[model samples]
Target: MATISTLSDLYISELKDLWSANDQMARALKKITPQATNAKLSQLLEEAQTGIADHTQLLKALIANQGEEVSKEHCKGMEGLVSEALKHVLEQPPQNGPVLDALIIAQYQRMTHYGITGFGTVAAFANALQMEDDGRQLKDAVDDLYDADELMSELAEAAVNREAAEE
Candidate 1:
């Protein structure tokens, strides 16, 4: 018979995955920020820096609260996805209308999607483990990230798509 996974173990594993993904994302965003040209994109990058810093601190606190040290295990899945996105971003730098915007939107979404999954998984684990306070905190962070993702998607549809199609 297959063994059922304990919620505590599941939570710990998911947190480690998220921690790893967040570290990688911080590195990726730092690289991509310099490439952003538009005012909106620049603002997004700056805001992302602040948000990520906050999230990193929170993750550390959570680890400590749980009587564990913050350690990042390798998140191979996220690494591959981030790597592919980075390649695309570098290969197709956004120049003027549409094309650049499309590329920016695509790249931003890739990172955001990874974060959403990681945050959601971690939140689920927290809930299962009956860590209500931790779950709420994680949920708040995830929601903010999700909002950013949604905004990026909207920008792509409203501005990038129309402009790119015309060019």
Candidate 2:
């Protein structure tokens, strides 16, 4: 961790945190994807893994562009969310089918919301620093996260929840 003497430092710190969070999510999604019985949900999870990887790379580039060492501060917020998600999975003895799919969707949205906020915040910071290009890139990432979250909600309301009720 470096000393935060300016907004740029704070911005870099937030980026590092988000980078770590995405990395953690990528790993967690791999574990959870196999537990999902819904084909759409499994596919989305796989896609999210790729998105997270791309976002992580963006963060690394942003940090390196600032002439700072590319590193990650442990993201405790994501750690807790991941643990809670795993707990939900473990609590359900038969981790398959619609019920599990519903839980996975819920957890997935929760984490996506976190990413949206983190990316949006960093984008704001970029704008404050007069870095328009960086702000635009970060905002694009945030928009992508929002799209994924909205899709999950649609899946839950239109399909997964209904299937869970039938189960």
Candidate 3:
């Protein structure tokens, strides 16, 4: 008789899916950089691309560490975010320079919040699973995710808010 083990398998799958989604986001953001009218927005998009790449690499490494084959399930959460961002970009044209920058900043914050929450959830799940090494790695990654969100928030407060308020 053969016994099947399910522990950590679902999480492993989810990690890969998230990795793929982030990789895709990086690629998309690379394309989106040219569309950014504001310099800060453009730089943030570039930073996001780099962050996404790092996340993808870390996720792949984590999956490998677990002795599981890397495979990505479809990530509907990211897809929905992408769709909403695109819709906003298309539908509501900014009235002025400051308004445009604020809109961009708002989109960036929304995306960052999503990533932070998602990563935090995964890290907690890893801890509960008793995968100490995986949990630690994921915890570190989640920290990075939070840092990224804070950076965007800082950029928004320093520049975007000022610009938006001026006009």
Best by TM-score: 2
Cα lDDT of candidate 3 equals 0.71
Evaluation by TM-score, superior candidate among 1 and 3: 1
1-167: candidate 3 lDDT, tens digit per residue? 11336646667767866875685566556644666677877887787788777887878888887777766667777777766666665456576766766666676667667777766777777888887787787778778877777776787788777878888
lDDT tens digits by residue: candidate 1, 92-166: 565664576677668777877888888888887888778999999999999989988887777677766777888
lDDT of 1: 0.76
* Tens digits of per-residue lDDT for model 2, 1-167: 88999999999999999998998888888888888888889988888888899899999999999898899999999999988988787555354478889999999988999999999999999999999999999999998899889888888899999999987
Q: Note the Cα lDDT for every prediction shown.
A: 0.76, 0.90, 0.71
User: Which residue pairs in candidate 3 have backbone atoms (N, alpha carbon, C) closer than 3 angstroms, thus clashing?
Assistant: none
TM-score of each: 0.88, 0.96, 0.83
Off by over 4 Å in 1: 1-5, 92-97
Query: Which rank order by lDDT, best down to worst?
Result: 2, 1, 3
Candidate 3 clashes: the total is 0
Point to the candidate with the largest lDDT.
Answer: 2
